[model samples]
Target: MTAPTTSRAARAALVLALLVTGLSMRTAVTSVGAVLDDLQDDLHASGGAAGLITTMPVLCFAAFGAATPRLARALGPHRLLVVALAVTTVGLATRPFAGGVALFVVVSTAALAGSAVSNVLMPSLVKLHFPDRIGTMTALYTTALAVGVTAAAGLTVPIGEAGDGWRQGLAAWAVVSAVAVVPWLPTVAADRRARATTLAGPVAPTGPDAAGSAAPPARAVPMSALLRSRTAWALTVFFGTQSMQAYITFGWFARFLTDHGIESGTAGAMLAVLTALSIPVSLVVPRIPARHHRAVVGLFVVCLATAYVLMAAAPRPTAWIWVVLAGVGGGSFPLLLTLLGMRARTADTIATLSAFVQAIGYLIAGTGPLLFGALYGVTGSWALPIAVLFTALGVMTVASRRSTTPRFVDDELAASPR
Candidate 1:
């Protein structure tokens, strides 16, 4: 290939790397969820075992997500992602064949661990490769991520029914995970070239020209320094609250709808609508300029709070409206991904912040469904849980508004006391 065509081919490969990796990130979680009942029956698992399976995504995301930055430093982000995809493929392909629930959970955890690391790496990879088009690239990848979540949720059951069992259904996603690895192999080669470039010269690669042309610069700020940065804290809180809201909706919203007198089938459809709406919202939110992010955050807060209020006050009559509003509010996730790029200058900073934000943020998120379930169990009414979630929206709004302000975590880290 000519130099120009070779560069174009490399760029195309990187884009595919982002899109497919995002598409695979949630497949391990949602495919199992789609066939949870069948899988539980086949494995003869108890309710608690099943619950642990359902909860593993956030738990794995928190623990492994925190470890990803260090892993990336050692592996190089591109090579680490190739390893992650390999792990994902193996875990997905194997978990379905386990004879017992214990083995199933173990392999499933492996799959989620891979997905978790991939999740943390995305923002940094985008920052490294497509720095000039963060908005567009983020929109593309997150939209793909949303599609993966929706497709796995919507299709796994039918595939299960058509095949040998839930095992076949869950294992089928391994194909997609394996395909996601292809683009990254070439990208790892690019990383090698980048490292060679760094070794051959005194001047370092920086900015958009550095895309796949140099290794990410060494970290200027230690991860511990983030503890003292207000911007980092604000982003963490914002990410946590939004993630909590999303997990609660996915985990409990169907029951919440059914409890409010909607038919079970309709409630399931509404939940699908809520999940599917994230695709378009993900596409749109990133295109909004940073100048208007505060307003965008306010709009999401209003949509979410309104959805909660309507669900609490007039759920059955306005169920569709609530779904639509909540769907719009789900844009918070894509918006946060965009902010992950905006809040850091260098690829290294983005990687650090992404890890810090998603690690503790996911731990915070993991509590929402449990807390919501507990509150409802205690009160025997959705009122208490809805009210609590409404309060969380308030917190998310404050944090998101603060984090959306034009500030870099790197600058804040520099100013923080050692």
Candidate 2:
């Protein structure tokens, strides 16, 4: 789809709309952790069942992300975004009404399916509208994402305590989800008009420059072909591995800190700190030149690896130190988001790559926390899980280096079928 033209005022409005949307993306996933114990008590959910609240983000992200590009193809990006937000609002609002584990899981899965679409397509939106401000806009929305996680994690428990309890906490985020859908209505109208205005000229029957040829440049590439790119594989490895480690940390770190003698309130706050500290890094990292991402991201990965080592060895007295280290490392989140936009030259390529990276990448990520918890169940220690996290971080470092190599994903797609 062609980029929509806008005046400065309209562009700023669109940016604000995006900021609001970004705030809703992680709320459904991160808020669950704060009230997980309470839900287990109230709903009588097993540890495994309660855990689905956290795991659903990665799973729905993979599942929903796999379908987002086609929706975006059939409906333009702006309209698909509006559609996703409306569905998210429903999912978020309906989830709090569940009286049992099964219903809650179903609603949350629905909510997160919408979440998945937003997460995968957001980078393409930034590239489509703010191509000149890739770093700035990427950093902005990503910081909004970081803020969303911090708010949901840090506030959910307190909100639950103040009112009717866990249900209130679960329903609080739906407000934001509903509000974020408003600014895009105008843009959706613009997209429809643009689509209708495109001329469908007849094909020039048989020449070097034929009619079907003109439309080929604007058509969607076969995603099957994209999976064959070595660069695409490397990007998936990078995105998936880091996300795997993050899912584990987001899902379990609060409880891990509490087990080390930290108070439950303090423990939840530490997880918030880990996500909160990433905000500045997310805002700044994407603005820097791509030439520097290798060293910058590698350094962050090393810091993240160090946090795992510390958590494994001595998580008690130095709890604050290690968690901060983890947050600093988390700043690479924007770097990853930047690559989604920066690696593609056109909007279509950006959307396709975003879908592939989030779809395949998140499916790989969904196994992380599940297996980390499973390994702990089997080994009766955090050693193996921590070691596994460190290994994932190492693989991520290598993938980050390659995905940031200043290459276009489309170029790789054009090179061959395989």
**What TM-score, over all chains together, does every model reach?**
0.93, 0.91
Alpha-carbon shift of residue 195 in model 2 (angstroms)? 2.7
Clash pairs detected, candidate 1: none
Worst 10-residue lDDT window for candidate 1 reads 196-205
List the RMSD of every prediction in angstroms: 4.1, 5.4
The lDDT per prediction is 0.83, 0.79
Residue lDDT tens for model 2, 1-418: 4566799888888899889998999899878876877878888898778666656777788878888877787777888888888888898888877899999999888889888889878887877777777788888888888889888887887887888888898888999989999888888876687673221111111211122222234446556767777777888899999888887887778767876789988986787777788778878888888668888887897798788888988899789999999889877778888888777666666777888888899888888877888888898778887887888888898888778787666666666765
- Candidate 2, residue 196: how far the Cα is off, in Å: 7.9
Off by over 4 Å in 1: 1-6, 193-220
Model 2: ten consecutive residues of lowest lDDT: 200-209
